[model samples]
Target: MPSEPQPAPYLPDPRIETIAEWIGDPVAPAAFPRHQLRWHNRRWAAAVGLDGFDETRWVQHFGQFAPLPGNLPQPLALRYHGHQFRTYNPDLGDGRGFLFAQMRDAGGRLLDLGTKGSGQTPWSRDGDGRLTLKGAVREILATEMLEALGVDTSKTFSVVETGEELWRGDEPSPTRSAVLVRLSHGHIRIGSFQRLYALEEKAHLEALVAYCLETYPGSPPPPGAPGREEPAVILLHQVVERLADLAASWMVAGFVHGVLNTDNMNISGESFDYGPWRWLPRWDPRFTAAYFDHSGLYAFGRQPEALLWNCAQLAQALSMLVETAPLVAALDRFGPLYQQAMGRRFTARLGVESRGPEQDAALIQAAERAMVETGLAPEQFFFLHRAARNAGEDDFGTLLRLHAPTVAADDAFWRQDAPPGVLIDEVERIWAAIDQHDDWSELHAKVEAIRDLGRHLG
Candidate 1:
């Protein structure tokens, strides 16, 4: 494996403080009955210079909500509005979670340490601001698997089992409870801008645009892009590119985010907040992750559309600062960017060199058709025919023959009979070990195996 980056010292730079008071509200953490450290991501910890913390100190900061030195004195449950399944709702914001702190990674990229099930906030409404232990475990698995599959996603930084019994209708009643912290690129969502737009807060909207351009620093829009020099247009373009790549990564990984609300669409474009997520058991595009999504609005196939719709809403917000035409031009970039990203990521997943866009697209279509026709799971298909091997005389085989192999299928990960996967059944099995016998052995093994796959893929 490549040498890990030297850990950066704990540098607290809560840049969000500059945005003023209206952006968020101060909130208190819950008084948990107990704090038992369940999961500590040592790899990410080492990357951020927090690996030196012993178990006691780790629990105090992450579980007990003790403020890290030089960080925010109080958590901020950010204020925002979002479209929940196409219905504009002004009453949406952080309820169970809050921005705990902000720090930089070894590479100087700003990261947010955000919480889930930490406590209740004003946005909590009538619902309890708590996360079930099963929910936390599911999020950990989702992040781990998505990261291994080359998805730019949040890192599950910590999962501490809080001694509490919570009742829920979804699963067994009075289930275990926990608190989670995720390390993310940023927490600024599309809905963040939407809130300002809805309120007609033009000055605040411009300030947000400026702040994002400085802190998140992205490349300007493509040549000839309308209003390419405008900060609002540029921010929109950056989000478009990031989200397009995010959608492609999910498509290639066979991941259904389950919920694609505007609030869930992070400006950093990294995928986070995994709830009711699923991986395709077969190559079915209509696969819906959330059981409540009766209309398949955010189904696996419609993810790109949902994402584009969210981008449109962002364009609507940016219109508060810039001309509608320029923002529309920025939104226009999503389609081609998504197609290009899809081609690039698909080739990487297939372990093959691209034969240009047209050929790549053809190969992708053929491979999808083959998977659907043969009823093969995506993981199985990629594992069985990696590097263009094991492909018989079918349309898929013909397309595979056209592309050059990128890696020989000889690595230990490839040699395994079955690839490391996080399908619902596997996730339930891992959780079952933890729930039934408190045996984390299976979960730990799965994480290691997933990392091994990542190493080989690299």
Candidate 2:
């Protein structure tokens, strides 16, 4: 019999080189004391034609940072500046991570393989560039949960425990260290443009804009939208639309990203870099995910506002390429787009068909009122009323009855009394099983449960 056929190798696409050299700094990966393979995203690995890698090859490339064939010979620590909590900070960049390689997925869409804790770079500043093992685990859970909930999010590609101890004020002393690799559409951020604008690199900024438009093709701004013909204006419009949808998705999922800095906002509008994130335990707009967020600038209820504010920063960057009027026109689209997105995503979460915008808004209002009056957690409320069933004979029920169920009432996911959630408590519980007992059963089970939830939602 003939031997089994081997899968074709993935072709690397180092497209970031299309931009000027000032955009990034090439650097070396840190030497690790050990490389213990922890988590491998076989599903996504298969998408990028890397599923055949064994543990040794996986550790060698991901943990040891050995350059992949025909890819970036040296990792590039990306450069950009952003406002951290609304304060401009020009000192920011890829302090702890770098672009490892680029490859097209099975669909032929360009994707990036970036690292989170692979090592330090010029942007490390006064802090050491190391990620705690627990942090990596939390990121895995966050990405999985977000992806399940239909958020456009980065895929946590790999986690390798590097034998080292790291000290941090927030985590336990001398916590375990690890390196994480994430797969994303692109790593260019709104702040990347801000950096170019700040440096007065108008020519480089224009090149970057053109590169973005070509690499991440988006629908042209709807006709009659201001400056729809201008490249900068078009990119701004696409970013606004994508971010609006993203903000709505998070609201429907009851997620608080904890941080909404301009740097954290991806140009592709994909959610990444999970830090201090939390899901709403109850329907409260003032719910915050970060302990240090004293002002609640990014509270659950204000996520849309925060995202719009970040969009304004992007507009400011693009001002160098276009007039302010068109950018403002693009910015003005966020409100209408966000409302529409909220209606659509909210109805989907409830497993009901949309009954037009006005009726959808009414249903959403009724649901919110029900949550407040009944004090039901968002997950519990959604699960209980999935397919618009079990809604009490109240205003919410009346509005829900106006819409038809999108899925069978007897669907497996809807049959459960509670929705599968990766709330903070669950995260801590899963981490405890790993940290104290070195057991991974809970983590593995939770991932499967989340995926099941995704399938049912579909």
Cα lDDT computed for each candidate against the true fold: 0.89, 0.89
Query: Alpha-carbon error at 267 in model 1, in Å?
Result: 0.2
Clashes of 2: 0
> Which ranges in model 1 have alpha carbons more than 4 Å from their true place?
1-6
What lDDT score goes with residue 32 in model 1? 96
The digit string of per-residue lDDT tens for model 1 on 1-458 reads: 01233577888889888984878999999999999999999988877778889999999999998998898989999999999999999998899999999988777877889999998999999778999999999998898888888888898999999999999988988899999999888888999999999999999999999888887888888898889999999999999989998999999999899999999999988899999999999998899999999999999999999999999999999887888998888888899999999999998888888888899999999999999998988988988888888878998898997785745677666778888889999999998999999999998999898888777676
Q: Which stretches of candidate 2 lie over 4 Å from their true place?
A: 1-9
- Of candidate 2, the 10-residue stretch with the lowest lDDT total is 1-10
Candidate 2 local lDDT, residue 172: 80
TM-score for each predicted model, relative to the true structure:
0.98, 0.97
